[model samples]
Target: MPRISRSEAEQNQADRAGPEFLEALARGLRVIQSFDRDRRQLSLSDVAKQVDLPRASVRRTLHTLVQLGFAETDGKLFRLTPRVLTLAGAYLLSNPIASILQPAIDRLSAEINASCSTAVLDGDDVVMIVHASPSRILPLSAQVGFRIPAFASSLGRVLLADLDDAGLDAFLARIQPHKLTEQTIVDKKQLWQAILKARADGYSLADQEVEVGFRSISVALKRLDGRTIAALNIGIHTERGTPEMMRQTFLPKLRSLASELQQQLI
Candidate 1:
């Protein structure tokens, strides 16, 4: 019989104990995530270090991924294959929400000549699901599938504001806010107050919180039932306007777009 790898052994134990989890699958997914823009190509040792998995487990996971055509190896270096995009493609194809929002975001970006994105809260971060940018006057941190800390993002605050008290408390308990910039509100009490303000105002803004000289304003995207499912935001260079100027010029448009998006869900 072939030798069972550590991941396989763990999976066997998990299966025997219960059916709620699959350790093998989890490890394989972690291997996939180990490759990103900054670490696009990695050797076996690099992947092992990044995922904190034993060399044997990482090798097995990489082999499985290569066999599935989701990754490729050039003898020594391993990189994700274009086939991996199928995963994102499948998600976009199956989800009408992404399709519905893309056109609107495109139009908005063109009209304002700025970047627009829609994100959903995931764990302690906000994951950008759709992004549209007309120009690159300033660098932006958001892109499709990109994740940013929720504690310091306008999109994050707008989505966080939708949580009920118990849910909000649970989130606050779990997330350790870190200061990303001079303007980042890392204090728990101060962050909670910001969320409360967003909840009352139905929108949120961040100035140099995620990055210096970048500003954003976000409004919640809701369902017909009035539950916020995601957030939509416009990203602008700080040189374009001050915070108050941004609100005065763009808030109405953002609110109108949010309402239009909500109506589409109905």
Candidate 2:
């Protein structure tokens, strides 16, 4: 390799100091995300392809992550360790809303006999912060640190509704809408209309977008200045209840819980 200019190297270092500082870290996290319930253990090549990174860079990053205990490898395959919880748990602990509201969320789950989830908007996805469910299993995936597309879930809609016109338009511009299920909304105009309604009514419902037989209702938890800090949602099995029931029965309780949560923030 040839020697590089000092100024060029300096500029690169400077770029790594601000918002751009996290590019490598972001790519590493994406690599971890590539390993999910379906793809739990991956080889170096597998991680590279999943994250769209060059093999050499991905290898270096993975080696570092393994050394730091964020990941584990058995010569050929790599998997995340339980220690990975520390990263997400740190975020939950540092965020006042998530810390303060977990007990209430657990109570809601216990009372409803359904799954309750809390999430924060992470780009165009809702990143699950806290999820509490009954001892009995549910039809949908509800776990801490899971993420769902913001356009396709009720939890997503509540967070989306908080965005202003410019933010909404920008988000809409980037997404290539697809039908995850027959009920998934693919039209941008219709989505905008739905979000507007959610903002007005203070709750949103998803009748099986990500999963075919599951439905969820959500409301945004707002700060005193009216910014949405997080979303709280309940997922119900569609076979057990009608959409009308979610609206008529669960929606009121969801609203009341959200209202109470907002007061705690103030």
Candidate 3:
């Protein structure tokens, strides 16, 4: 018999897993998530490095993704195909929230001449569920379905602020935050304070923590029932304004857009 691979051994052990736990399915999704805005294409080794799986396991996953029409490869490198959008499209089409906000989001981004987006907190990350950018795309431009760390932006802070004390504490305990930029907040105490301040002020502003020369301000989007369901934010280049200028000039515009959405999102 040939030597079985490390991931193969792991998969074989899935037979012992709980009835509801689908180990193979979980690993498949992790392999898919390893491709993102920063990593559009990857080799077998690159994927193994990302998902921390054996190359043999990564190879199997990649070929499976290819057969499913979710990904494609040119012998050496693999990239997700447009067919992958079908997965995201299903959510966008089914979720009334995404559809309700997209047109307004586009208008807001155009009005601000910047990128505007909405996000919801999921685990340790904030997923950008809807987005629009009127200006040229930058290295940091986010689109629909972008998942960024919850601690990295104003948009995330608003969502985090909506959490109760127990929920916030639970999030803090599990997250292993790292610096995304020089200004990124890696300290737990500071992150806690930022979230508290967002709760008190009804908004949060982050300056260049997610990317250099970028700033964002966010306000929570409350439904008619007064639940803070998501957050709305606008991305601006630092040259566009100082922090104070962002407050004086752009914050109200962002808030106004949120207010209009609140009326219909009920």
Q: Best by lDDT, which number?
A: 1
Model 1 segments more than 4 A misplaced: 1-20, 136-138
The predicted structure with the larger TM-score, 2 or 3, is: 2
The sequence of per-residue lDDT tens digits that candidate 3 reaches over residues 1-266 is 24544366566666567567766677789999999878999999999999887778778889999999999999999999999889889988999999999999888777767888889888788888898886574536467787889987898899999889999999999899899999999999999999999999988999999989888889999997889888998888889888898788878987887788889877
- TM per prediction: 0.89, 0.88, 0.87
lDDT of 2 at 204: 90
List lDDT for all candidates, in order.
Answer: 0.89, 0.84, 0.86
The digit string of per-residue lDDT tens for model 2 on 1-266 reads 33322245445765767655655666677787888878999999999888776777788889998999989998999999998889888887898877788898899989989999888889888888888999885555568888788999889888988888899999999998898899899999999998888888889988888898898989988877777888989898888799889889888888888888887896
After the best TM-score superposition of candidate 1, give how far the Cα of residue 102 lies from its true spot, in angstroms: 0.9
Model 3 worst lDDT run, 10 consecutive residues: 1-10
How many backbone clashes can be found in candidate 2?
0
lDDT of 3 at 176: 91
- Candidates in order: C-alpha RMSD to true structure: 3.1, 3.7, 3.4
Q: Candidate 3, which segments miss by more than 4 Å at Cα?
A: 1-18, 54-56, 137-139
The full ranking of all candidates by lDDT, starting with the best, is 1, 3, 2
